[model samples]
Target: RQDPTEEIQNKREEDLNKKKKKSAPKSSYSSVLIDKDQEPTQSVI
Candidate 1:
């Protein structure tokens, strides 16, 4: 039988890599946005 544990680990790693790639751009965008008008929004939040 195939080893399911290894398969699961591979899938989890793939998912984590995809998440990091997706978040990378979003984090950069937020940093740039806040730098423009962050103090007002930050205090409101």
Candidate 2:
């Protein structure tokens, strides 16, 4: 049987990985700033 604490730790690591992937690249402040700078001339379809 798996230890309950080990299962919880694995679940937490998986959640953190998902969060990191979702928050990569454009989620960085530099990309956000660039998008803001371009907003004046860009339109969303």
Candidate 3:
């Protein structure tokens, strides 16, 4: 019999990795915004 649990765990890990890749850019964007908030003059000056 195949070990379905291993396959399921692998699939979950793959999904989590995909989510992290997709969200990584978003977090970078938010960080830029946060920095802008802290240094609006630098960003707009």
Candidate 4:
């Protein structure tokens, strides 16, 4: 019973949010990347 158009709209919104996050300032973005890098190393231990 789900509407296909509504699902498409939700996907579009998610894409817009991802784009906005990518456009964020470099300092915060770098921190996010660093956290991601550390997570894998921590898991290996």
The prediction achieving the highest TM-score against the true structure is 2
Per-residue lDDT tens digits for candidate 1, residues 1-45, read: 759998999999999878876879666556666778655343321
Task: Tell me how candidate 3 scores on lDDT.
Answer: 0.72
- Using all chains and alpha carbons, the TM-scores for the candidates as numbered come to 0.49, 0.53, 0.49, 0.50
Give the 10-residue window scoring lowest on summed lDDT in candidate 4.
Answer: 36-45
Clashes per candidate, residues 3 or more apart or on different chains: 0, 0, 0, 0
Ranking by TM-score: 2, 4, 3, 1
Query: Per-residue lDDT of 1-45 in model 4, one digit per residue for the tens?
Result: 779999999999999878877887555456665877664232321
lDDT of 2 by residue, 1-45 (tens): 999999999999999978876878445445556768765433342
Candidate closest to the true structure, highest lDDT: 3
Give the lDDT of residue 15 in candidate 2.
Answer: 91
The models' CA-based lDDT, in order, is 0.71, 0.69, 0.72, 0.70
Candidate 3 per-residue lDDT, tens place, 1-45, comes to 659999999999999978876879666556777876664333422
Give the range where candidate 2 is weakest over 10 consecutive residues by summed lDDT.
36-45
TM-score computed on alpha carbons, candidate 2:
0.53
